[model samples]
Target chain A: MSPTGNRADWADDEDFDDPSVLPPQEVITNKDGTKTVISYRYNDDNKKVKVTRRIKTTVVREHVNPQVAERRKWEKFGLEKGHAAGPSFDTTSVGENIIFRPSVNWKANAKEAEKEGGEKGSMKDQLKDKKVKCRICSGEHFTARCPFKDTMAPVEEGTAAAPGVEAEEDAGGLGAGKSSYVPPHMRKGGAGGGEKMGGRFEKDDLATLRVTNVSELAEENELRDLFERFGRVTRVFLARDRETQRAKGFAFISYADRGDAALACEKVDGFGYRHLILRVEFAKRTT
Target chain B: MRPILLSGHERSLTQIKFNSDGDLLFSVSKDKIVCAWWSANGERLGTYNGHQGAVWTVDVSPNTILLATGSADNTVRLWNVKTGECVKVWEFSTAVKRVSFSPDGNRLLAVTEKRMGFNGTIAVLDISYGENLSAQAAEPTLTIVCEESKATVAGWSFLSKYIIAGHEDGSVSQYDPKSGDQLENVQIHEFDSQITDIQFAPDRLSFITASKDKSAKLLSSRNLAILKTYISDTPLNTASVTPKKEFVILGGGQAAMDVTTTSARQGKFEARFYHKVFEDECGRVRGHFGPLNTIDVHPAGTAYASGGEDGYVRVHHFDKSYFDFMYEVEREQARK
Candidate 1:
């Protein structure tokens, strides 16, 4: 209740003239069983701020033994003597919520979850296929090991010998590489359609084939062996049951080249293995 | 599930126990004070402030009328659970490491540490629910002294038929409760790896022993037969068998001294859940910053509380998923 109505004279309005004086809080009950509270307070900057909060109260009734109900009324004693009701701030607090789901393959699940959140593991995986390119001669070797290291500077620092290398180095190094975001179409060398998302993995996906109708006893190494005849298989992932650890009758095989993947798909389709005919097709792009 | 944290202890927590009703939780710590809290909300009901030294262990009577605590003060003190007043104190030659109430609440046992010139002993005192709560027996009814190896933790078996004691040498012994004579002794864990904690199953027919050898074993209390073993990477500090759910919660981590040398993930300060029958690790709930020193399951198995070396007691109520988890065979059996 505000004191404005209780004031005896208009001169009492002097209290409101002060900038520090805050208006009385107002609370209104809504029809939907919620209460709206509006209050005024001075913030850290000495500016008047209005706060609004909606409060909803729900009653949860629990049945318990009468003895427990009686014990709940016991008085605080010893060190906590004379304390008020509810948990004290110093002695009790609610901690972060923990998702505790029990599963048979908890170890494997935990490792996978950790790998997703772990920076070191993901960073290693990201740089798994990254190569060391010589800055001077564009060879598959370190710049210090390049044959032209003694005579030539790094392509980025060189003057006129390698224009293509300079442009490539500029696009990779100084041209919107870090510190700022540049749209794909606006980046250097953007005329030929800039690099796509997923980086090197996009090329690997093009060389991946989805093999279905595989026998449940199929193993990753077995699939790798079957697919490696066409070309060097980069990865073979066989879906398996988490509990039984048995293959789920499908697998994905990625080759080093899309041509090898196409050849494998054409030859492996409808091929019999373990009394089941396998159906092979190019793995569809996922999202 | 959101865990409620109780921060009444300033130093590391030693033990925590839930009353038979599962409504009240009692926790003792190395800070010399015992705290009683409502298990549902983690509201501190009161504090037992008479212990002069760090309290090593605590147990509430089956009726929840008396709370007994063993402390480094070399005494076992019984307190009126509701009033938080010390009812009786029994002095011993060495520090008391563990205290437990019998199944019927008529007898109390205290495990005294082997220190100075005294050998470790498990003494049973006759508890009375007389008109005056302070009117407890002054002397123990029987004392079982361990001459070869010191007993670290002990508890009463089913129907109080036997007293099971876990020793410093990782051996478990069953003794006749009436005569205090050793009935049988068996090495349940690795030799010389001390047994840190022993908690009885809901039926008391079996018990779980946590040892410094990084393993917890469920042994039949009658014959000390190892029924199942749950192994972990870090040494275990405490283990408890949940009642309704066929799960056992094991808590441990790197020793508190070595905690500074390892990160929290490496420290393994999470509560691991193992299938009681299958002995497979089902899940883990991580929260504590330090080693978990003690764990107690709710009598009804709806919730569990853990005390950590970080000086906080966390009470977690089980979620629906905890109960819904079932192996394929179990699901198949349920379908039948």
Candidate 2:
């Protein structure tokens, strides 16, 4: 069936069946002196497409010197002999627009613009007096790199246990008590749940199988084909070193159903591939 | 405003000049070719060929009938503007560094380099616009030898009364056009710094000099007295005075050899605009990737073009804001 709207002639219906042929373009002048052009072409999918465009033209007139006007008619010579009129793409191009406004205090305005662009400088100034006291031992370092991170809990655990008594103590010696840190899971009466870093993948954990002992030479496509015997695989993620681009002996394979995931884990745990035995199990949830 | 980029040269540009009518732009470069472009649309009109070495400078006659170029081939060649044909060639003992046409287009001056036991000299040739362009004088009418410091750039003063030349030792000297005798000499810039460019005002009463000392100075042509100074952060290669407005354009950056060691922002490759009377920088337009080698404003003062070491010529036409900017005192004077 012809999909174009308002076919004025019966001959237009016959052209739709023949994909190789296109109708001639039509141009119409409107009342406001605008032009409307309709043309037909074949798109990438080999389907016939019709394009309609409206264009307005304006003429700009400029007065130049008589000598300049005479020189404009000179012929191109040397390397550009007998070339087409107008600028060629290889020799001339329009650059990105630049906004230039003359001002009395241009240097001051430029400095302000630079300050706005480099936001890190202002942020450093705002954090000048702030200290980097660690949570483990109150050292001047990050909590993750602290020497006592693995051995001790946070230093203010007792104060967090008794908030009512600690409030009174905090009011008396505010500077001494640097125990204002709170975990995300314990904030706002502990009603809202904690937000995980990669929370979007939490729901897929049940149907995902963690595959370890993967050979460095094992490709993702080979692993997918090997695991496809048990179930329909939705995704396969292989961990690789950034520099060497070699597999890191670990991968994750997700299935459409939890039953298929369990079946694949049991069958693939003792399977041998690429001179290595694969060890597969259900993926554990990240804290 | 959007600039029109002309990429006709394959090597670093040495000089660029706009004709008196401000419709044609002539550019010479190290690529041994001279390209003439339409200033309005960036369309290349033609290329003048036949130079054996890198072209150093280019200038168009006031009548727009002849074009002259100096080159490292130790020769100066003139071309017919309409046909791009070499009309004549004048040979010298050393490479020609600069060339300029007189205000009335009746005389041409060429500055030759000092090399291989040859002292630097400024030679003036009489030009004729008769029916036969090639039947020109084979010898220079007069020659001025510089014993102390070589002349880098030279031009004629108003009414062709005095020939002003900028020296390699950062000094400017005025000489009698007929006698070839130095009338006055003054040190205008830092003592050992070389002057890179010298361009005259529309009336030729004064001129601006760009130097390696990171400053551009406007001086009176009659007595070589420094009138105004504009300080920049980078060594300037070229400076030009606008005709209809009270602004001067300065172009420069870090030296070309050190360009690869720094980023584009740190290189400071921009065309700076300064108020001629107030000596305050109004704004800057940045586009080139390397140091700017030359800059020329349109004779009508509506547009300007700059050539850089990156081998690109950018032509910019001013908008409303450029003409509307005025200081408080200037506005009050206009109101009166």
Candidate 3:
């Protein structure tokens, strides 16, 4: 039987019939103007008996919905296949909102610590169960009172003075008063951060060089090769034509080592690369 | 090749951007500080301070002289990169979530969420105007208030003629910068879907959007018709398109709350690269320990940077072998 047109093909099949099952009915009108029909079964119940439709065993075994099957295949490939009208019932009732989904809980550990340990405890006991360290310096102190919190232009001169005095009073000072000085922005109650230790690379490690009269045929690799010997070329952002996606006469080159960058600036500056002069300089550091 | 990781932020990294020159890398975190880095050497420059709240987004002017930041403090601040001082602050009645600079660097676009209503507002300010003015004098040049939806992302189309904003309800609204007239407001995804990011392709004919519904789509910049979809196993938080490689990088992870106990957590933290034409994943990059919040491809297309909930920014460059593979793929597309 054709999978899509199952009813007609199933009706035509004559193999293995069951006597108890009733066939679908058809009505006809005679020339005498009376309607006539033949029936193998009678509706004895006061309520009209309903007819049942059955598919052939072979047809039922072979048919498949391509769309649904294709969706399943994509799911295995790690891609969601279709769009949802809105969030599923589970998400709306549980996930909350986009910024804060039910799946994320950044405050989970902090909440657990507060619930079990209570507020009056030593710094160790207070953060004993917490997953993250102080957000300011990633130090042992509370995020609000982290000593490194003052790194960003101390909000109030008085607060910066307070930390120094507190440091002396607590001989083995733990950074406690730090929490009370939460920055104005952080204290306003959106997503706040804890302090992290200073990161690698200082202000002096950066230098920017420019390539002038770059050939349209020049590729990123060629520019990188020209400066790679001077130092590690971190990035080469080639200005290109929007339409053809070709070099647009100039490119900026950045280096990983300050000394190497400076040397490249002095030596390569005004030098020729593929017959084009290079403009090299310490790109002004954004204060 | 291994990715160069920059560590410093004490909290979740919210956004990262390469300046117009690609010499500087700026990253903002929930920590309330925006740190600048030498993109080439992974050197940390000075941090831009003054926001009293978590900064949501940041952008640099095309001239590379000024930086604009949006924050939950309900203000948009412009800073002189050389001075590290906030040159001007524009206050609003709502939190500013996204900011963008026009190609010409003369205007700044900000998307702000109202304090109480569903409507998000887009304000286009003439940054070239002199600083320090009365509240009335500082009014935006154009304002497009979204109805029944709050914007999550906003930007100026290439050429700076149009302003487009994406909303929490999967609706994208466009406005004529000249008159502030609403031109098109269409639902680009299923209802109740949130737009995570909207980045225009280098060519500007199309833009890509990442949605919380586990799909990233490439749509016509003009009509907003979805041209292609890049679906993923986890809800995508951000996405970026590489101009040269023709690959889309998608990032996300299990919700922070579920990470500790979930058995299938690995898939959530990996950034998958998908072929733009085939929609098939080319490869996966695994490095981030937590959910990735943002990803940005350098204009040169040789490298990309990502920030994550782990409070670290990672910069990945294409190695020789990777470039070879890209060239092979490019040839295949050209032949087709």
Best by TM-score: 2
TM (chain A), candidate 2? 0.38
lDDT of 1 by residue, A176-260 (tens): 4765766546666553432432334467668889888999998888888898999999777776655788876777788989999
The local lDDT score (0 to 100) that residue B315 gets in candidate 2 is 97
TM-score of chain A of each: 0.37, 0.38, 0.31
Q: Write the per-residue lDDT of candidate 2 for residues B1-336, one digit (tens) a residue.
A: 999999999999999999999999999999999999999999999999999999999999999999999999999999999999999999999999999999999999999999999999999999999999998999999999999999999999999999999999999999999999999999999997899999999999999999999999999998888899999989999999999889999999998575567542588999999999889999999999889999999999999999999999999999889999999999999999
Give the top-scoring candidate (DockQ).
1
Which runs in model 2 stand beyond 4 Å of their true positions? Answer: A1-25, A40-42, A45-48, A112-126, A129-287, B258-264
TM-scores, all models, native as reference: 0.69, 0.71, 0.52
Compute the interface RMSD for each candidate structure.
Answer: 0.7, 0.6, 23.6
Model-by-model DockQ, in order: 0.62, 0.60, 0.01
CA error at residue B310 for candidate 3, angstroms: 0.8
- TM-score for chain B of all predictions: 0.98, 0.98, 0.93
Model 2 per-residue lDDT tens digits across residues A1-287: 24466688898778778858788788989999999999999899989999999988888999877887888889999888999889988889999998999999998898788766654477777688799975433458887876544333221242234454444544444444456764434444322222231232444668878898999988999999988889999878776655788886877888988889899999999899899999998877432
Question: By DockQ thresholds, what CAPRI class is model 3?
Answer: incorrect
lDDT score at residue B259, model 3, on the 0-100 scale: 51
Candidate 1 accuracy as TM-score = 0.69
